[model samples]
Target chain A: MPRLDWEIYEMIERNPFFKHIGFELVNSSEEEILLKLSIKTDLLNTNKTLHGGVHASMLDTVQSIALRSLYQCPVTAMNLDVHYFAPANTGHLFARAKLLQKGYKMAVLEAEIIDENTTLIAKGTGTYKIVRNA
Target chain B: MKLPVTRSTFFEYLGFNSTKTDTFHLDLPLQAILLQDDGTVHPGVFSTMLDISMGATASLETNSFATTIHLNVSFFDLSPKENYHAKTNIVNIEGKVITAEGIVYGQDGAVAAKAIGMFKASPIKQ
Candidate 1:
């Protein structure tokens, strides 16, 4: 992965949903990207924990951030597998993502969602297809 | 022997709608906020829909609340319009774990995605 600076991360943080969902980029590099999100009632499920969809969404976005910083291109998710280790209902949640592998057409990335105490809340692995820059 | 919509703000934000008429089904208007740069429905949105649908199916099938343990989705197509549909059914239920499968259909009636989710059936805490 090519070295990337902060500008690309800033550009992606401008997404409305990312903002609406309250995702903060804690750190960004070519190797990995770290994001933090506040737990809000709106982001909760019926059981009062961070909703499954939100976790999946954040994983998708964070994994893409890792790939985008390197490929400088938009990516689409082909497959996503998420495992919930525990419920995220309080405090802050952090998502850390890194590229597992990349090829000519597809890239595999992995991410983990952790609580403020660094407890693993959820884990995700996804395959993204890199599109050519327009 | 039916459950309510199981209110959730995230579902409302995504414009998710559920119905009960012999079978449970889900529908959502492809909102702009849920679209990727290429204008297709984001896979995360699909995941959320699948999660909700499967949860609803588990609730209806087992008549209890469920917490999602794991979910896996595969994308087969993409939508080019402003709407999508999802239908789910319980594939298996063994005591406390329920497994469900669902399909997402694009507006053009093509299979856009499919997902399988595992949920833990339990009583609502608090």
Candidate 2:
């Protein structure tokens, strides 16, 4: 298991929304970050499947985490595009993210969510602005 | 017009409230649990609100259930830890597919984010 940077780990641990959603940090490396969430009743939509918001949230977080792994400054999401391929109704879901481009002030990343069966549930691409302290 | 749709537990968990008058609107109280490290409401909150509001609007208009196929969100401004409002309108409908657009307003009434969603409509089982 690669050790996560103390600062990044603390940020994730202190985030209240992450706790509210029960997100677990599976692992992290310089190249990527992985997050896990167990499907619960509270995570489902009216159709009894994983809510699109959950997928979006997980994808966004994982991608941001990947950026955090590479930069010390804070990052904010500028845009997120998500496509749902299948519905996940049971078991655990895993999200993996990788940085695709790192520019002077902006970064682009891609993330995907898969079920325990390795089924592609959803995928997203996000652009984030790296906030530099003056 | 009331939408014949069942509320999702995830929606309730986010503390989002919905109303339909001239259009579909969703309101969210920026709770402590929704804030990020920068004291700004997480973008996911806005995305979720838009997705739900737009999907609900599509479903209500089509008289069926709509599932999200694609959602694209552009964040124009970071929202403070304050109340937020979202309104959605159907852009077009073609057979089983519906396209909708939504805008989220921050406490200061500034446009926080804009979203376009495509959903697949399915017949409501009687």
Candidate 3:
């Protein structure tokens, strides 16, 4: 894996949707990444809980970020599966994603979202295409 | 029965306008907020759209609200489509559990994504 660089950090910071959702990268490496999102009223659903789409989006993003950090290349998601365990309404949410496997053209990842009390909110798995060109 | 649409605040913030075009069909106008930095819409946005569309389909078929238990999606290609459409149908309903499938079509008439989900009747609502 290429050494972690500053460009990725800047890319994440500049990502419009990432900022729109307010994801704060806590730590990241080739194998795993941790992201934090402070729950806000805008991010909630009709039930006053974190939106399901937010969980799906964070998992897809964190997994892609982890793969990009590992391969030092851009990637796109090919498929994703999400299972919700609990609903999160308030407090901070954390997402942890790990690269499970990597091939020449594809990578597999698993991720989990949890609340401040460590309650599991959702779990997801995704397959991504490793883009070789820019 | 008309396909259902979500009234969630998140959907509102994303500026997604969903309408049931016909029986078990939903149409959503995509907004710029749902796009990624690279111009393609985010996978999460697709997932959310599919989830709501499929959940609504299940509810309409069963005549009650349903909670999503699991969702699986396969994406094809990303496009700068102005709007997206989804067609959902009930695969089967056995007791309290229901399985449904949906396909998302881009404005260019390409199949952008496909999804199958499992859901159960909402205990709180039903």
Candidate 4:
């Protein structure tokens, strides 16, 4: 188990969906991390614009991914609060998240969604709870 | 156009009695299955859609500028059929926070979910 626990980093690296969405590890400082993603056509919503689900999914995934790298056991989102400043059109989307505070088993994440132009399209925060599975 | 073409008909169709909604307006008989896991409509789909509806209703009530800041949702049950429907209204608005509460009825006209949200108005620099 000691060997496998140390191998989670490599296991996460092999996830196909994370690779397909082009989620990249850019930079990190303290508890904050930056993730870069490409704007793909299939990520759009029913209005031909960016789907809200995509935004939620991407934000949720990156938060969990970043947490996995730092925590002994990964956490899940309990609630999400998002604010959209403008429409996220076709272009590169960048999500940067930071750990605002971490409790014994809960943490708060503050993140922003920026486009290629560095425009802030959405701002979000979530509460995560860590639990034991095995 | 993140919404469907029938988005306009909601005003005349849903029999509006409150004149305001905190959620987005969506019509019934959606092209989604109520129960499925294989990329078919997941249970969260209804919640997401309902959240969107509530957020949209906030935009309409607050002079079309209110943005979603706090959304509280509670799920009570699931739809037995594939049909989807929702109706909402603005409950109140504080100085910076606007509150909207409404109910989402299942295809059988039973309550499936109830939600209350607070949308923060943009800060004005004066």
Best-matching candidate per TM-score: 2
lDDT of each: 0.82, 0.87, 0.81, 0.56
Give the higher-DockQ candidate: 2 or 4.
Answer: 2
Off by over 4 Å in 2: A1-3, B1-5
- lDDT value, residue B74 of candidate 3: 93
Give one digit per residue, the lDDT tens place, for model 2 in B32-75: 89887667777788889999999998988988889999999999
lDDT of 2 by residue, A25-133 (tens): 9877654578999989998888888899999999998888777777776899999999999998888999998778989899998899998889999999999999888
Model 4 misplaced stretches (Cα beyond 4 Å): A1-32, A45-48, B1-47, B55-126
Q: Comparing 1 and 3 by DockQ, which wins?
A: 1
| Candidate 1: regions farther than 4 A off | A3-14, B1-4
lDDT of 3 by residue, A1-134 (tens): 44458968877866777888888998765545789999888877655667767888889988877887888888889999999889787889999887779899999989999999999999999999998976
Residue range A34-132, candidate 1, lDDT tens digits: 888988888888777788999998898788778878788777788999999898787898898877898879999899999989899999999988887
Interface RMSD of 4: 8.7
- Flag regions of model 3 displaced more than 4 Å: A1-3, A29-31, B1-6, B21-25, B123-126
Looking at model 1 chain A, which ten-residue stretch has the lowest summed lDDT? A7-16
TM-score of chain B of each: 0.90, 0.90, 0.85, 0.63
Q: Per-residue alpha-carbon lDDT of model 1 for B1-126, expressed as tens digits?
A: 544466678887778887776778788887677765556666788899889988887877877888899999987765456678899988899989999999988788888889999999888766
TM-score for every candidate vs. truth? 0.92, 0.94, 0.90, 0.56
